[model samples]
Target: MTAPRTLLDKLWAAHEILRREDGVSLLWVDRHLVHEGSHHGFAKLAARGLKVAEPDLTFAVVDHYAPTRDRAHITDPQIARMIDTLRTNAKAQGLRIYDLTDPEQGIVHVIGPEQGLTLPGLLVNCGDSHTSTHGAFGALAFGIGATEVAHVLATQTVWQRKPRAMRITVEGTLAPGVSAKDIALGWIAALGTDGAQGHAVEYAGSAIRGLSMEGRMTLCNLSIEGGARFGMIAPDQTTFEYLENRPNAPKGAAWEQACADWAALTSDPDATFEREVKFDARDIAPTVTWGTSPEQALPITARIPDPDTVTPAKADAARAALDYMGLTAGQALEGTPIDQVFIGSCTNGRIEDLRAAAAVLKGRKARVPGLISPGSAQVKAQAEAEGLDQIFTQAGLEWAASGCSMCVGMNGDLVGEGMRCASSTNRNFRGRQGRGARTHLMSPAMVAAAAVTGALTDVRPLMNGRAA
Candidate 1:
């Protein structure tokens, strides 16, 4: 008789090549994703005179510094150099790359699942922290540092200290206008940033299962913001349907068998986790971040929290955040002025997110300047085909190419200093968008609502009489 094992246990055991005396495990790398920032790893490999151990298993992308505008005429020499470096490295290493010229090029996290490179029961690694986005497909995915990246490039294996397993179950259905982004914010707000530290969180129950593949990706993408090692959900019909016919997914008989195997990847009924948390979906609201951290979020109808109201350990940080954000405590969060809006990122830049924003922006006009970049070129084309791009432009927003854009502040699509932006991107950390910039993280629809009202208006009111 075997004991009930969690999804993490199964994934860890399957990929683990060996366990060291120090409790460190050597894991077989299934997919290694690299971007422009990975130049450090490539440089390390070059200095060591080693080639990528398994070029076919590695993939390079030009994202971090990818220009959202005028790719053919990138003026920033530094940005151009970074993008070219990844291209040269990938070509020299014989690894596949999705460069700016490639139609499939997009954010690493977005394209991985878009092309079906992410799958159930696989371990994925990337130099970017948002690598957990792939875990939405039930893969064990997490970010790696420059040294770890080099190690993987040299051996196609990585050393890791196994993280404990935690399960967060959200029961019941979400109210209209509420979304996965809200659920993520709600949990982080309740638990604070370090709530799931050193734990690989598996989201379960009705609400999680009901989320679309894109929603699941958004939810998992923000796991790191809450100090989670990674986040995952059991692959089911929705997962299989999303992966069906993807470019890199298994074909025909292989696909059928793959789904069957993935179906068994769920945690057993009797599986026990190191820690468990539960949330009633109905209690979550359309949420937004007021402070610098993702956990400093609250319901749309709430007021900015007073520093004194925060825990003694966090009160000073809360005060500092308020000062940096130029916000006052005890003020209503709704109707707070915003200088601009951004509606894209790996966190909320998929086709579905665009559709949600478009549904809100349609037949309306934005009161402030904004940029809307698609997650990938494929998503860009899909948005154009569906006239979502037209809706954005008609609503007074710039329709830009696919890339990290303002979300990362590396590609020059940045928010002005002291500017307040309602963004769909994950992470509201000070200077995340740009130095001296103030960011309020929310869902795409909520960003669209802010763009229209030029304030932090609850999307629910704007969504009234509109399809959710």
Candidate 2:
């Protein structure tokens, strides 16, 4: 009799090439995603005179340093140089690159699934932290450092230690006005930032299964914030349907075979994990981050916690975060003034996120400056076709080209110093958007509400016609 295996164990065993005495396993990488920042890795490869081992399996994009406003010419010299370097290196290596003009060009994470480059039971790697976003397809995807990127380029394999497995299950139906982003924020708030350290997390149960593919991506995208290298959901009919008709998806008999194989990718009934946690969907509400960290989240209706009331071990850090955010203890997070609103990022920049924001801003005008950048060129085109762009622009929002704009403040779309922004990006770390900038992370609809009211406002009221 054989022992039951968890999904993570099955995937790991299938990809393992060799086990070494140092407790590391060499695993095959099915896909590699690179961005403009990959210049460092390409430089290393050039220094060693090594060409990419499997160029066909690798893809590149000009997202990180690409300008969202002006597409003709990048004004910043340093950014232009990085983009040119990526283009030259990718062309020389015979790897497919999604240039600025490419209709497929967008954030690496966004384009991967849209193009069918991400599939179940495969290993994926990228040079950005949010690469875990691909795990929504039941793939073992995670971020790698620059050195590791060079290694993958030289030999489509990476050496890694096996991580412990943890399963997070959510049951019950989500209430109206609640979203996957809120579920993620609430979960991270319940579990500290280091809760899933050295582990691979698998999300399961009714609530997860009920979410759309975009919602699943949003949930898995935040796995890194919980200290997990990988986050996954077992592929099902929802996953297969999304991949159908995609540009690179398997065709004919190969598609049938692939679906059959993916059907068996789930964990055995008796499989066990090293850690398990459960949540009821009904208990979750629209959530927002008040302090510096993503884990410093609270339901929109709740008041901020006083440092004195927190655990003794967390008191000092809480106090410091509050001070840096310029917020006082026990104050309500609602009605806090905001200077900006950003509605794009790998975490929540999909077409669905844009539609949600548009629904809120349909008959309203923004009270603050808002920026709307779609996740991919395809997404941007779809929004325009649906007239979502017109709604945003008419609501006093700035509709820009697709890229990682205002997410990291690296590509000239930065929130000014000392300004507070209600953002749809994933992280809320201190100075993540800009030096001395305060970021309040929330869902796209919530960001729209904040833009309309120029303050941290609950999205439910706007959705129900209760707010101005």
Give a tens-digit lDDT track for model 2, residues 147-242: 999999999999999999999999999986788899889888999888888999999999999998999999999999988989999999999999
- In candidate 1, how many Å is residue 366 off? 0.2
lDDT of 1 at 208: 97
Q: What lDDT does model 2 reach? A: 0.92
lDDT of 1 by residue, 309-399 (tens): 8789999999999999999999999999999999889999999999999989999999999999999999999999999999999999999
Worst 10 residues of 2 by lDDT: 459-468
lDDT of each: 0.94, 0.92
TM-score of each: 0.99, 0.98
Regions more than 4 Å wrong, model 1: none
TM-score of 2: 0.98
